[model samples]
Target: MTATDGHGLRADAARNYERIVVAAGQAFEEAGSAVTLEEVARRAGVGVATVYRRFRNREQLIRAVFQHIVAAEIEPAMAVETDDPWRDLVSSLEATVEVLAGRKVVLAIARETRALDLESMRRFVATMDRPLRRAAEAGVVRPELVARDLAAVTIMALATVHPRDPGGADRKRYLALLIDGLRPAPTVLPPPSTPDVHGV
Candidate 1:
């Protein structure tokens, strides 16, 4: 069966795959989408041939690299306290910025969403959208805000905070501004509608 099958990779292959993804994430962050596969292999302590065997092309490898990083970073961050909807939303956005800043594969995926066939992207948006809408209804976040608007705000915040200066004062300030902007205004929403129990 192919690697795509549920057969599972061999121990050695799994080790090599992990190394390549870690190395590629760092290289991509430092060099952007132009990072070379040769450098990734070199850093991973594996031969270029092995890297190629695992991922036929740069695009494939980049996708794998991003998936790995997101699993490691983003997923875990979301598991923290989310008792307050507004705080949870801000924390999630901050975590995304941290992950994207250090993973150019993520940046590349964002840049070419049309080409990436990534189901995770859709799932992520849906996950965030639910809480965002709830936060708006609860008067925690702006009623006029949509999930896409929040996503745009995150992208803008990341653009303003350079990767090299992650966690610096400027990054903190930008995050604060983003959180502040998301806060609900008293006059923003219309009256709530009652739930429809019967089919129309």
Candidate 2:
């Protein structure tokens, strides 16, 4: 939000901005980028013009909502205190997935639209990189596991929590399986369903 005085937002403008951002954050979390500006404005109890004044376009509003969510939910999880890297890692993963469970569409749009270059997204990746490196170095997980891999695991695990499985039993089972696989223990994995079928 740009300040009219170049120092801080005026009292009313700040409140409007906060309301619109908060409303958009919830909308995106619930409906992702598919949520419209009018819906956001309605949720915020503001006029569409007010939302438009603060966010010039849909892309700008989406990015703002993403930034708000990262700051409110995801960044704080990064501070989860624990002595065990494995527990710390898994706890963070669980917490993150809980947040992302509602925002899959937004995440997909952000990635597929190449918004990875956004400063907020870049900061998220940089913050996650540290924990990923630590988990690998401490042998808490597979050595090759990366932050993006954790994201993939979250997606796969939470995909089961969608409307098709509203009770979330599948989500829980998938998450448990994912956690088991992450442990640094030797175990036999099921054979691939189709091994070299293409034989290319």
Candidate 3:
């Protein structure tokens, strides 16, 4: 489905859909992919038929849950303001890490599907290109660096920071080091010598 049929859903149906998605997100986070659809329906105070009607299958429900969480969390962080592009990038990364930490279901989905294929990773990097370019142009991040490099670094840092059992301090320290490394370095130019004298 390209779009939700907002008009078609009765108020009660809409509420049921919303509740199911929310419950699914929480359940998936706590229980990973093994969480049952029946449990989601139970948590939402709705019937199993309602949950299935809204989301045909487990994968669809998982994707919808992810999208719902992203709309709530990451979308807001993208609106942050900072004159320093590097700072903005750091802030955005921090926001992303925080969201991922809170929503283990997203991580579980990624692990289950092995979703970080080249095309998907490329699209992910592309999404950050505009912001990274702005940061680079503003001299906040290294001008020679590209979005792909940043994406790789961020992914690596997240991996180290988010172990099977991660802590808040680990996340903060790793991200801090990553952000520090992303900052632009000062450029150096050699001193000019005086001009040569003309021949007599």
Candidate 4:
């Protein structure tokens, strides 16, 4: 079974799983998702069989890597909160943008594998719920804005990130504009084209 499946793995197996994920992250950073499982196995110092045992396919390994990166970089931003929900929301969005923009190879893999990312996106949207709710309650953001809307806002901002510009100047500019749109406003939003799959 995979790392998250069935019972927990034994200590040795758990170490291998972690190694494979870490190695895959490195490989993906260097080579994108097209890197072979054998290459990841080599980087992890594990046999190919071990890699196959933990992840049935390349897609599975990429998903694991995606989850690993999100946990390492994004979840911390999601968890931090202060008395000011608007500030908290803005901080979290900035962190998210920085992480995603800095990892261009990871973003390319994620874009190529979008068909398999609905569940991951659902989990991400769920994490934004508390901040969005608090922002609306505090009258800092429009009540009509939802967690899914924040997800879209992030996507819109990320689209402006320039690969050659390590500082992400354009990303910050567009993100600030999108953040302004979140402020309490008289404009009524059209019904979301896509429903919130995680149900808030």
Candidate 5:
């Protein structure tokens, strides 16, 4: 093959790979991670073999899509700034829950990934911590409330709203309830479902 032909083939392959990752992320976000690889290939406008060649199995493709989400969506959201730290923390928490509501791939990553790149988790928690502490000092959440509660509340409030849900109403309704429920109780806070601060 000519050098020009070789360069074109390489470029095309790279494009195909990108297309597949993008398509897979979109599919997972919309339909959850169980959506078939064939559906991903079709949405990407490539043959099924192309997806399989890039990702040997459904699990690998789902992981790649989660990586894409971390890079593309979560990172940008984390960088968002606002003068109101309380608002910032609350909105980001809600957004995260909304983003992950039905995403089984992310949930799987949360449950299974042995060595998750949790740096983002740490930073996100720090961001939430400052505002949360400020709110607590102002008597919003109880003084005893820790940073983990923010993550716990966000996940528990939204995890039930999967892609199979009829609408976002339930998610929004309960998220608001959970947020307001944080008003300082006279007694100690109850134990949360997951102990780790990071939801994903």
Candidate 6:
């Protein structure tokens, strides 16, 4: 998977870039965000100068790794057959959790650094539109449910993936509970509230 930021790179440079990102993803997953550029260079089998030439700083490298994860890991979860909309939605979410569960520290760094690619996020959200709409039409999910809501729920469920629980039982349990909330409810929820950015 190519980084969203990659542009006009020569063939050798692109290969080096891909290697660095792959190495960085593994390093971040294993050792958290504190792993150094030199370490990433060593892991990539590239010189430290090569890493420096590609990414000016740690944040840049982290953002590229984040983008790579989104492309390689998260995006594929949504590519499902449309024969069963509800099943597709659930499978997509479960796949997302499976990809994310082992990389909690990398997730924390992504949030802390705001290393999100909004355009890529938008594309993923768009992929959910058809399944979500079909599920609502079948009355399997609440009509009010939207793609952004699923995105938010996925983020919420990630917190349940404890480092100690290698099996991810708690993550599955909590995510199941959250998914249950998406079903049509007897009582209607109050209108959703938007937090005031100016107040914050």
Alpha-carbon lDDT, every model? 0.68, 0.71, 0.69, 0.83, 0.68, 0.79
Query: What tens-digit string does per-residue lDDT give for candidate 4 at 73-177?
Result: 887898898998999999999998888776677767866876237777777777788888888999999888878899888889988877677778889999999
The better-scoring model by TM-score among 2 and 5 is 2
Instruction: List the candidates ranked by TM-score, beginning with the highest.
Output: 4, 6, 3, 2, 1, 5
Whose lDDT is higher: candidate 1's or candidate 4's?
4
Error of 6 at 51 (Å): 1.8
Candidate 5 shows a clash count of: 0
Question: Who is ahead in lDDT, 1 or 6?
Answer: 6
125-178 in candidate 2: lDDT tens per residue? 544666667677888776655565566577688777767776667877888798
- Candidate 3 regions exceeding 4 Å error are 1-14, 114-130, 144-150, 162-167, 185-200
Candidate 4 residue spans exceeding 4 A from truth: 1-7, 194-200
Going through the candidates in the order shown, the clash numbers are 0, 0, 0, 0, 0, 0
Q: Residue-wise lDDT of candidate 5 within 58-136, one digit each (tens)?
A: 6677566656665665556655657664566567667767666646555654346442346545544554566676676
* Overall local distance difference test of candidate 4: 0.83
TM-score of each predicted structure versus truth: 0.70, 0.71, 0.71, 0.88, 0.59, 0.83
Give the Cα error of residue 133 in candidate 4, in Å.
1.2
Return the lDDT, model 3, position 120: 44
Query: Which 10 consecutive residues of model 6 have the lowest summed lDDT?
Result: 191-200
Candidate 5 similarity to native, TM-score: 0.59
Those runs of model 5 whose alpha carbons end farther than 4 Å from true positions after fitting are: 1-17, 28-39, 46-50, 102-148, 162-167, 181-200
- The total number of steric clashes, by the backbone 3 Å criterion, in model 1 comes to 0
